[model samples]
Target: MPVTTRTVEYPADGLTMVGHLALPAGADRRPAVLIGPEGPGLNDFQRRRADALAELGYVALAFDINGGRWFSDPEEMLAYVMPLLADPDRMREIGHAALDVLRAEPRTDQDRIAAIGYGTGGAIALELGRDGVDLRAIGTINAVTTGRPGEAAHIRCPVWAAVGSEDPIMPPAQREAFTAEMQEAGVDWRLVVYGGAQHAFHHPTVDHTVLPGVAYHARHAERAWHDVVGLLDECLPVVSPA
Candidate 1:
């Protein structure tokens, strides 16, 4: 199926967020997926993911966290994202705004949507699950931070998280804590640790170093993507019409 792409502007967190929407061919409703960007905000990388999902017959929306801007400076990006991480309510608000945009689309199957995010975007997706949103599934990469006490109990769907074993930001202790929270909450969750990979291993290589411990691992990136697709296939499978 051919894929179509467009830019959508929506209000969120006191800024006009610019999201990239990709639609699969045909007017019939399809399962929608939310694509969240890394800490640096929405860029060509995430937009391409949306397009790829569309090509696979899904309605995908790559949402923005830094409104319409993309930050190449790690310090500048963290200065903005760090505060939001502390405030779960604010992150949920941003996720909900994008969800609203996605739900409003005529081609979306409201009840069969899933959320997949990377880096900071991954945290947003997890927050949405903690907020008791109706999601078919939640998948994230490299944002394994634990949520507020008892909040994981609110997650009503299966959760999948992935991280590089050598990711300093999401060390063994942090991953253990996150898994403990999910287990205690009785939520269905799974975590995959890619050995010998560093933080942001799923991201493509950049000209300059974005942050310490952040590097791209081509092999691990592909494997992680395959696993995420498997998660969606199991939880939100799209059946073809006869």
Candidate 2:
């Protein structure tokens, strides 16, 4: 079946967010996924991932983070995204806005929604889990961060996270802390550290020259995608429409 794509513009907080939605050609309801891009915001990379998920018979929504704008420079992207990460409430609001958009689609099986995010977008997906939104699976790449320890208890789904072993953005110490938090919260969680891969290893289009701490590894990217899709298949299985 051919996958269809469209732009979905909606209001998030005070910003007018522009998200990309992809739906598989089918009449049956299917599990939905929300894709969140890194601090630079939504781009071709995330949009393509959404389309891929849709081709697998899922409704995928790649939502905006920075008001439909993406920054090329690292300093500029950090300057804009750092503040948003500091405030959990704001993250929750953004996630809620995107979640509502995913749920509103007629083909979405609301009961089996999942969220996968990269960098800051991963953090937003975690916020939705912490807010007790009842997601089936939560997947993050190079974006796992420990929230308030108590908040993890509200996450009612299995989580799959991956990061490059040499990723400066999320080092061993950070991963350890996040692991401790997840263990304490008793959430079903899995973590993978790809050897020698750098931050944003899953993003093939990301330019490491412009972004100092990030680099792309095609092999690891493929492995990470397989892991995430496996998580979704385990948590939110969809029967093909004959």
Candidate 3:
């Protein structure tokens, strides 16, 4: 099915967030998935993911947490995202605001919502799960854990997380710790580590030259994307289009 796209604006912590919303053509209501960006704000990567989700008969919203801004450099992006990460409440607020926007869509099934995020965006999605948002499933790629002890226990939905096995930023130890915490919390979760992959493994634009520490692995990216889609399909089962 063809995808219809629109720009939406909503209030978020006194700032107006402008996001891109994509839905499958036709008027049938469908499960919605909120797609969050890696850092700074909305970008082509997140937009593409939203469009892909729409093709799968979902109403997907790519949220702009940084008010529609983008940074080509990693340092600049970190400068913007760091402060937000420091404040747990702000992170939760941003996720909640995005979730609200996704739910408010006329063609979205509010009760059957899911969220997927990458990097910092992934962390935000995890925060939403930790806050007990009514999401059916949550998926995170190259996500950063809350680090704070026992944070995983609060998550109520099933989670699917993927990270590059060779990623220096999110190393095997961290992944192990996160898995341990999830197990302790008794949360339904799956952790996948892609061998030889590095940070931001799903971003097509990412290259070793531009971001010295990051390398995008196409194979792992494709596999991880399918895994995420499968998880959503299982948890948020879409109604057949009439």
Candidate 4:
């Protein structure tokens, strides 16, 4: 399927966030998926994912919360994202701005919208859910959560989370705690752990074996992609032709 790409403007934090929107062929209004990128800003991998989602019949909006920037070093990335993550209100505003942009697109069915995020972006998605975004579903890949214990309870949409078993940052213990918290919050949530995978496994930038200290499993990455698409299908069904 062919895809169409366009730029969108979202105003927040006294700055304009420029995002990429991708739509599938035909004149149909499709369910939209708001995709949040990992760290700094949107990258090629995210843009490719947006195109892939468009091919799957969704109007995919790849959001730019970081105002179009990239940081190669881990410390530098953390330095840039930590403050934003710490301020829940700021995160919520940014998320709402992106959601607004997605919901406004003529090709998107605002009522059937969903969101998926990666890493820090994943955290933002969770915050959006906490703030009651009226979404169909939300998914996070290798995401981190910092809200209160019972915060997820109020979310009306189903939540799905995927993590790497070998990820040192989000280890088994943290994942277990997060699952327990979700259960206590009465959230309809599923947690999947990809065995032998590490943080950012889905990122194409991570090599298979060269990063000695980090583990990256390709099999898990491929499976995770399919899993995300399947989840979206379940949450945001395609409207039939009249």
Q: What are the models' TM-scores?
A: 0.98, 0.97, 0.93, 0.92
- Model 2, 1-242: lDDT tens digits are 68999999999968999999999997789999999999988999999999999988899999999898989888898898899999899999999999999999999997999999999999999999998999999999988788975999999999999999999989999999999889999999999999999999998765534576688899999999999889888998878976
lDDT, model 1: 0.94
Ranking by TM-score: 1, 2, 3, 4
Whole-model lDDT values for every prediction: 0.94, 0.92, 0.85, 0.83
The best candidate by lDDT is: 1
C-alpha root-mean-square deviation, each candidate: 0.8, 1.2, 1.8, 2.3
What is the Cα-based lDDT of residue 18 in candidate 2? 98
**TM-score top scorer:** 1
Clashing pairs in 2: none
lDDT tens readout by residue for model 3, 1-242: 47989888987856888898999978988999989888757877788889999988899999888876777777887788888877777888988998888888899986788988998788889888887788899899988575456777788899899998888888878898888888898989999889999998988854323555688799999999999889998999888865
The collision pairs in model 4 are none
List runs of model 2 lying over 4 Å from the truth: 207-209
After superposing candidate 1, which stretches have Cα over 4 Å from the reference? none
In the predicted model 3, the residue pairs found to clash are none
Candidate order by decreasing lDDT: 1, 2, 3, 4
Between the candidate structures 1 and 2, which one is better when assessed by lDDT?
Answer: 1
